[model samples]
Target: MLATFNSSWFKLLGIFTLNQTEVKAFPMRWFGFGFNAFGQICVHEELIKGVWSDAVNEVKVSTPTELDNQVDTSDCCLTTGYQIRASWSRRASLHLDGFVSNESCGKPMKESRGCKDAIVSESYLTLAFSDRLESWDLQKKEQTPSWSMKLKPHSSGPPVNLPLVPGGYIAMKPPLYRLLSPHLRAKSLALSAEHAILLTASGAVYTWGLGSHGQLGHGGLTSEEEPRAVEALWGMPMSCIATGGWHTVCVSDGGDLYVWGWNNSGQLGLPSQGLRKTLLQQSSQLAGAPCQDASTTPTEEPEEEKHEEVFISIQAFPALLDVTPSCEIRTVSCGCRHTAAVTTTGDLYTWGWGDYGQLGHQTFISSDEPQRVEFFREQQMRVVDVVCGAWNTFAAGVKEEVA
Candidate 1:
């Protein structure tokens, strides 16, 4: 299924992974963790029960917290996994599977013959059907659906007044902002707090916008007006790419993870000043500290004498990270100051700023290297996909039942 969207934050949420024998919906679950001062990642009860207080924003979810939102199933059926349409322009669409009916004619992904795509801006909502694209001016409509839910048998009349949620279908139109008009043949695009990264159909990646934090991956801290190829990543074909507040991470077709840009919060999965300080504190308390592993865990003897304080504040070029010795990466996502990835073996790994437990390691401690989340593993579940919010991480997976 060919997927396309206009927002820089758009990523296919796997809306069509159904069993061949059944065209109906399948059961899916969502697990979220990290900062929730705004209750954006809170479960239904957590959002409704907790009252705003000075210490509320200080609360952080340090582990995989099962997120539950009451989605109305009266008008539609949720056949499969949930979706979180993260978009920079605030425009997004949740993909689902319905059927051919009168209500689906104007649905964003309603039973189209060709590739389906959407463009949502402040003034208009344009949809690309099989043979043609249509636009509807929002200013002309009296009452517009809260982000139109896209899929076959589309349900389009839900009034959405809250923020993004999972477990149901929703089409989120951008509140308003400048639109991204990519001149390149880009297949996937991701937007950071400042920089922009785009992956072409050929698997080559290009970056532009703010580079002050090396988020541009241009080997220097210089901004760009037009898209420029990242020389360090040349010759390698990447399958996925993502951007964070000031960092970038992309997985090659071979499953190797490459990261660049800022490391202040260890977002690059490389040793950062903060992590080093934590390590030093641990070493002072313990006899020996292991720093040989790529995760920078306390496993091997420290090599600090052999090398100066080997902490990276900024990685000007792409750095290969061996997150797991034998496993390959299938997908990756970045938060404002954290990063998360799903391995080929169905394990989810996370690193970086964990002040609010976005790392999902059951702790608030931050790491300078990738650490596999044990929640899913302990539950005998295989994580298939992951997405990052500004301060939280969500992983979608299925239980791996013992035979």
Candidate 2:
């Protein structure tokens, strides 16, 4: 008989050991909603025993208030526990009711560090987080399904047409944009979409927007009004790019990994959190101080006249991953506060935000540096692909059979 509790907020959540040897609690005040507006739970064995023995309170409620638009379940709703239900190759669509703890809760002996709840259906892109649920349609943008549910913002009457940011809309769809010339495609996308990134079939990189902590990789604190190519990686060529909140990481074609921007918790594989904190302190601390060095830069050129000002501040810079030359990583993924990677040798490594076993090390302690996932040591497995939820990790590939 498990005890259950309900509240508008969950700050009172806490856990205690069955032996009474330890007690810990997550700070409710600091428990801000994440990408998916849900919380994750990763606990030790003793603590789970207490929960199952009716010593704890569980939350029970339906989410999204209620399904606004009904769809044909005959075409969807297999409910396998993946965030989206359909395969990535299919055209089916479905809504998900994801709660990190919902799929993860089980007896202590079978603890899982991967996503506990996900509802993915066949859609090209299924992105879920503590803050938002996003899906992309690669088939036909305009002809595809559009949001139908009406949302009532705090003071609103009814949700109407979703408001677009200034200069946010494009007359053409994503496929058309991809088919257009690279320069034209780049110019059309919004500079402010958080997930925006430029990738070449051969792996070049560029970015803009929300560079406060230098997530843009442009070596500046200012968000660009337009797309800017990442010159530092001009010739290197990249295979993929992933963003984690304000931080970013890229993978190279030769199984090499490069990371930069917002390394607050060692997400960039850097030695300090100084760079991240500097960006938050003030806009002036960023590299693109529009007014600095004005006197020395010469005011003769009219185009350069904008440099007329004076101030000293911190600036953003691209920091390379400090890993040794031999690591040879192949795939990279980012969670809201952590990162995971799979190397060519079939080894998996993870770091940052282990509070809910997001690191999959079977521990709640966080690490500042990349740590090989030793949890699978006994299984002798090989992780080929990796995906990260807001606070959990998912990997697929081959693993040795158990005796």
Best by lDDT: 1
lDDT of 1: 0.63
Worst 10 contiguous positions by lDDT, candidate 2: 25-34
Candidate 1: TM-score? 0.68
- 1-403: candidate 1 lDDT, tens digit per residue: 1123222212211111223233233244668777665444544555534533446544577667665434344445533333543322221224344221111121233332232444343344444433333444444532333233333322442221111111221123343223344445566667665677878768999888889988888889999987799989899999999989899999999999999999998888887976777656666557665534334454355666444457899998899999988989999999888899999999999999887778999777788888889999898888877878777777777778679
Could you give me the TM-score of model 2 versus the true structure?
0.51
lDDT against the true structure, per candidate, is: 0.63, 0.43
Top model by TM-score, which number?
1
Q: Candidate 1: where is the Cα deviation over 4 Å? A: 1-26, 44-58, 77-80, 87-183, 278-307
